[model samples]
Target chain A: MITMIELAESIYEVIKDYRNHDNIFITPENIIEWAKQFEDNGQLVLTELNKIIKETYISRVRAKEFIYEHILSYLKLYEYSSIAQFLIDTEFIDVQQIHKSQPAILQLLEEVLTEKFQVSYLPYKGFPKVNYIYFDDILASGSTIGRDLVIFLNKKNSSGQKFYQLIQSNEIKLSISVFCLHTWGFEFQKYRIQKEFNDKVLKKINWFWNYEIQNHAKFNNQKLNIAKPVKGSSSKINSYLENLSATKYEDYAYRKANTPTTEHFFTSAENRIRFENVLTEKGIDIINMIKGEAKSNIRPLGLINPQYKIFGLGTHFFTWRNIPNNSPLVYWWEVAGHNWKPLFPVANRGN
Target chain B: MKPSIRTYQIKDVVTFAKTNGEFGALSNMAAGFNLFINEVNIQSSEILYQACRFPLFPHIQEEIVRTQNPMDAKKVSRKYMQYSRQDWYSIKFKIMKWCLEVKLVQNFDNFSQILLATENKVIVEYSTKDAVWGAIPQDDKTMLVGQNALGRLLMELRERVKANVINKSTIIFPPNIPAFLLFGCPIEEVRNDDYFIVDLDEIYA
Candidate 1:
């Protein structure tokens, strides 16, 4: 049981630089005010919120060090492994083929690389290329990374050689290096890429991530450790789902929260449900505030594809750069004059 | 061999239920071969198939799906016998076959490779009591006897795998029937397992 003041202070410390209007970079008071929306469960919200901040939040320094470890130190060992035989069999690391999901992380990666590799990553094209390593904050649904790769692979460079052609030919390879990835979304992303190219380019692809969240609930054996509350858990949640546009109702979103195989992400199973319920309840309240025709992507927890129709993607991971749209709305939903203030003012949303 | 029985030398057939068996990945009870049907994560095909028995009682399906072990999931289903769908007796085998098909499609790479490894040798589910889904050791301990419905379905799956037709489908149609409901929703077609690939063992424990 954490006091609101103590929890708010710790949260403010972690996300102090979250951008705001006119010197409004988030403060402790702001955190307290936001939790009050939950009323009697306000303390519970703060308790869970504090848990999230303590366990999930990433500061700038911490993220940069991670980038160094994955891209340089860890990747070195990977090069000679059979998993990365394609990298060695083909050409040198394609240092310049950086797919930056956002400019800041790429810039952070470049800084980290320059410190270790001791070379300029940019302005050095035409080097013997083998693999492309993408650095991003987190891969929530994999749509952003998948879409980028699809567009990049389908398009030809100045030489009229499609990137997919290069990959299929084994002349070049691809690997995505991200901070964290969801087990379900990671698979879906790979599936999307292969489907786009008709399975001709998967062998050339490799994936590296420091953390993977088992948030998927498709399997009966799966215990969803992430924030998926069961339907009928509360009248409010049911009413919320029932209120959705009839033509756009998403039935798949109304699944019961499965037990996680292990309780690694949340502190405990009881706490996990309490946290999910409060956030989902508040998430619905927050979205209900949207003026009219709330965008299809606007979900209680976070944003997803407009066509997805599910309550958000329920991604809990965060990075130094920003929170992902796939995260719950309680973490990053910010709209002016809506009487709502997201503690972590997200950086890149709706891109 | 009886008309329904397909006897196989115990040494020639593959058996799975335990996670460590050579072809254990083919077992509906095996861990790590999680399926995502209709954009939902099912821990195994056994759980999903069992959950299908009580579609009208979604809460029971939810309880069944929440069980970590497939055997436990079956217990959960049994506890709610009063809520079992009326057509369960007639459609049970078809549902089991559909569930296995889902397991095969969702876990095509590993499951199919293992199914193919059986290599036309009569596949058998070694059992002592259950004759419907498995075979029992006959008087001769060297061979087995029973309906072996699971084994037959698996052999059919091996052919489908060799056929390589349904592997790419984004959605799998349910067995054409009067009604197939899971979680109170009509079963149309489930999303292909290709959408997500769980790098098991590498999976976060």
Candidate 2:
């Protein structure tokens, strides 16, 4: 009958000789010995074997860990003064801090507007005079944010014009300031202007308000009609907007216990210790045992209806021309029911 | 021992011809006869027994009936006239040679055994399960093609067996037949009931 030892041997050969890497050598014989030791120490089931392999080999590193160790260090030396200063001085800024920071920035902008030009704070009764838009870090693939920004800008610009007409006779300019200007914002602004005035403009609009459009020709000629139907469009958009609105002013706690680098180092060390402990308890040198098992030839279990007929014993012998006499005799023997066990030379020694 | 002669139907003749690669030649030779294997002559004597169904040439049926006595070899040969004697004999020789070569026949006590032996050496009849030609009747032209294919296959098997290419038998069953005809070798009916039986002893003897 096929035993756990055989399975362990096969698995060990597969894993050890994987990709022919010289550094990673785990033989079948050694693995079998290790498994026997584990069984002797009271670990019996194959599920336990799977657990041991997972604990020993599979490395665990979360997405958040990647973000902290690799992403944060590069972000520290950002050219933007305010964002860098904020991260350095406060250690971290949560959503609430973002809300607080926005108002202070706006207050500074208001002061600048007042001192620099004739400005009026015309608070529209129906819509709030001050509007804020929040986004996560690095807004490329502007498809999502572009749509939101366009709607907001269009509403604010239209309302700002109406407010100017109501409050002042002279043209009053409007300004937009975001926490960080993404590298591709200029392309998005150009795209918006070209889309809005697609048919009306004789030549493509080269500039949008004061933002100098980079890749203006590319944006102008772009065929930005909805390429394909978005999946679950109505529900997905509604839920995303709802979540953004709910968490607009919420505060998230920031605690740096250990960066992922140190955490991963500790994790590797812990895994090594656990492996060593298990090996010591079992009293098996795993690598050597697997090698030994691989070299041993196991006997095959025999066929169900054994067909053995000896004809013309002393006469002319006839054998198939194709099959060589020296070739290994491999046979499958039925063990219990439908299952068949393959016995190798070692197992078939007496037979 | 009485040598029994059995008459075969057109379908059976076609099948034998196909398996032996003589269908085309046989069909051409047997044209206008309306039947095949007319007056089965054993040794030099024509067997005259109404109990056994006999194939008769359409033109000589009246002559055969009036004679009442078994015709001489010359007379029987004349009555069972083939369109082309040379072509007919050549095709017959080729088919008979092929049958001998493939060991489709096994001799028991000097008689050619029509039924092949199973793995246990038990005589297996040429039923729908074992007989390659026992199936539905095909047109004369198609029968010719089938005969030719069977003949070629038999020759190949003969060479392999002789050389001992493999100890085991390597006969391939015919494929691509209508479901109804898929079961067995085609057989000719005599008197609409009597079926042809392979006589193993006579051929070997």
Candidate 3:
């Protein structure tokens, strides 16, 4: 059999080409070492993980293509289209100071705008006005974007109508563009808007996304296309679930017992079971090693609702910049005291 | 006597209620039969049906959807009676039938399996208070009487399933009535196996 380091060799080739992978100081050696954490299963896990990275790792080159493609699709604007006035009129939202991803995403958007359109427009830099367009990398629980948009919409302009009221009156429109979106996250965002503003304002907003995560994680869904575990009937999973704090999300604590009627996310049905089980079991072991109360949002698999009593959102999505905290912890949990090393140590986050 | 009672009375019947009985999957209140529509994860068809009552008030729809139980969804509807659409009474049957169809499409395996189990028998919703969507026992358990709107819809659904004629796309196209909405968003067409959404500007205006 190949050595553990050799097992990670192939992924190193892929990782080297992963564009925009800056500043976290990862190397091929780190990849090999990260795989060794799985010991005997190291080779198998790394191979499956390599497949995902190849499929999902959005190099800067690819992200630019995606950004340009989607922007054109949204604007119906082109290289020849009149964009000077439209650029000045759009306010790409920069409200998420609670996390680092939104700022980073805006920065990337700025670069793309300069390259693709030759507009000196810097995203998240100009005053809020005109047709509002919010840009973010991904939306998980929707708290950050929801809270941010709420603040922006409640603000009053010189005319004294609230931004939401302005939107309802058709003085301007709002659009959201993201690399990835979760169905639940979008719903939660809508719920936030409905509670704070009204649907009339919501109707003025549009959404554009490249990758859609279909893990609504509702109960009794037999075919899940996201990273959820095999059922928690297993002794370890059941015990972990039973011990969770009471939460309304307990209904989503497991993927349906019969799952992945189609394995759209993973390599295959058999491999999905293999990869998810290993990742979940490893995640639990990592959680056990936590020194104390691992924040309310932390879970065995990844991040979820603070009150959500499930394994996690099982987000398997990734980008060249960073893995979302909503992904399985085995991908991004880098606590200093923990025994396991994350495959992708997140950059620029307080975590 | 109600003139409609005889027209709706059934002798050979398969009844559903109590949510856990043999034919309970036919009840809108049954658990494990959820639906994803217009990007919202609806708790039950009852919640979806109640939500259809207030298309203009998204807040009411959210209140009903966030309720933990279906019975409470109805209570939530009654709580905001004034906000209900003016044309609700006239359009409710069309909306409820559409909600059931959505339940079948989204929860195809469990819903269709149970629906096919009824085979050729007349399906009835056993109810104590609601005689319109369901039926009331008139003579012992033998005679079930009332408008039986829900039962009639189910029988129609059963026949459609038997003949394999569901459009696979009507959940988003709900019988061409005005103001059929969830969360105030007009569902246009099924985007994929996942969601139903339309372009915003054309309909939002």
Candidate 4:
């Protein structure tokens, strides 16, 4: 068995060749130790994890093409519908807070979707607004869309129409278009929106996903169930999850499905303190624990969303520009002069 | 004739509820709590059995039978959100809170009857210090969704289950009457008069 230090060295060898603009903090050493503590069946080695990171990492070119083609096709299909008449007056929205910060895909959409359909940025145009499509990269818990909608609803447009008034008067419809959507998140949003809004307003809402992941953790889907911790680890993980703070509504967003492996071990720097306390209580160093006999619970998935019950590690989805905040805090959270480094640096929010 | 009746423990009910259908016996949990919850109507307390309760917890339901396929696996997550023992207690507490908030029942006895409505396959016998109020049907085809109902509507369900199951028990109580009953199934194949009770008191204790 490789020591934690050795494992870190091996990991460094693999990641060294990859791009590094903003230096990520967590070393291969930090990860190996964390993994040893978290995974029960301790067979995972540095080489395997390195392989997963290299293979799963999404590059800028691939992400742009995937978004452009999927959105373009979705728009083409809707072009012939009677709703097209209403949609021609549609306005594209920044639902994910990505328009200014992570604008590569959005720019691509503007180039292709705008050219294909008669679209406008502002609502001041004489055409009656019929459709509003909010674009984002991922939808994990599904609350962000509702949150953005609340923001949009309160803003008065150049036309002096409250977005909420347009929605109430049946003058406009709302929809969400995304690249990745989890099954549980989609249903939660569906039930929540239905319960909150009237039928007419609900009827005008739509959800479209380029890739609909049916990883709800309930079914016997072997591929998706890969994250379930076996016996010894299962109990430890369960207790850890059960004890997490459930103070917020989003914190309560848990389903029976196996917690996605993509969720990170820690959500943020503050979350790390509590997680470290659990390790301290165990009184086991990274190198001395018994070797695991089961499959590692961690997934090779690239992205993490701390909002997910997993403390922050989520599914393997990633984008080219910046790693999402949803990814494990270990990979993305960084403070000046801090030992912790983000493997995938996030886009500067000021942009 | 009266509908056959039996008693079960909540622990056994939890086990039976988790048996997975297609994965072979003991391979997977049959279905989650959501499948059972969808069939219940708390406000009306109306018992519905057919596609929802056919064979009273068959690997498949009427909808699955008619569709000739298993229920969509994706839906199980949304309906059966409880994953652990604590999760189950949390959901039960939610139902209890809802019952109280909605004024579904005035007292704890009637409120406890809501527990009888936990599963699709149930034998509910409602009574008080004086008389037996009503009982759910025991048949291969029919079962109860709600443990007890308050009015002419539940009277109708009781009649339907009894008639369809070829039993002849009449509704004996008035609406808003308070009563309690135990829910259970046979331990194995037994006579209509015989049943194996799960000793819910001990299990809960």
Best candidate (score: DockQ): 1
Q: What is the DockQ of each candidate?
A: 0.09, 0.00, 0.06, 0.04
Given candidate 4, what's the lDDT at residue A91?
62
Q: What is the interface RMSD of each candidate, in Å?
A: 11.4, 41.5, 16.0, 17.0
On lDDT, the stronger of 1 and 3 is 3
2 versus 4: better TM-score goes to: 4
Better of 1 and 2 by DockQ: 1
lDDT of 2 by residue, A79-141 (tens): 324422322322111122332233333343334334433342223223422212232222222
DockQ of 2: 0.00
Off by over 4 Å in 1: A17-24, A77-101, A126-128, A157-161, A198-200, A220-223, A246-258, A261-264, A348-351, B1-188, B191-205
Instruction: Give the per-residue lDDT digits (tens) of candidate 3, residues B142-161.
Output: 67776778878888887887
Off by over 4 Å in 3: A1-7, A17-22, A77-80, A122-128, A219-223, B1-47, B50-205
Which regions of candidate 2 are displaced past 4 Å?
A1-101, A110-149, A156-174, A178-180, A196-351, B1-205
Better of 3 and 4 by TM-score: 3
CA lDDT of A163 in candidate 2? 24
* Cα RMSD of predicted structure 3: 15.4
In the range A1-351, model 1's lDDT, one tens digit per residue, is 668899889878877755432244777898898888777877777776666665566667777787777766435644543323423343323223233335666677667756766554564444555666665667877766766777768878569999899888977667777778876677566555654564447546777777666655543344454686766559988777666653322654754544554666666777777877888888988888889877766778677655454676677777655677778888777788787777677653434
How would the candidate models be sorted by DockQ, starting from the highest?
Answer: 1, 3, 4, 2
RMSD of each: 9.9, 38.0, 15.4, 16.0
Instruction: Judging by lDDT against the true structure, name the best candidate.
Output: 3
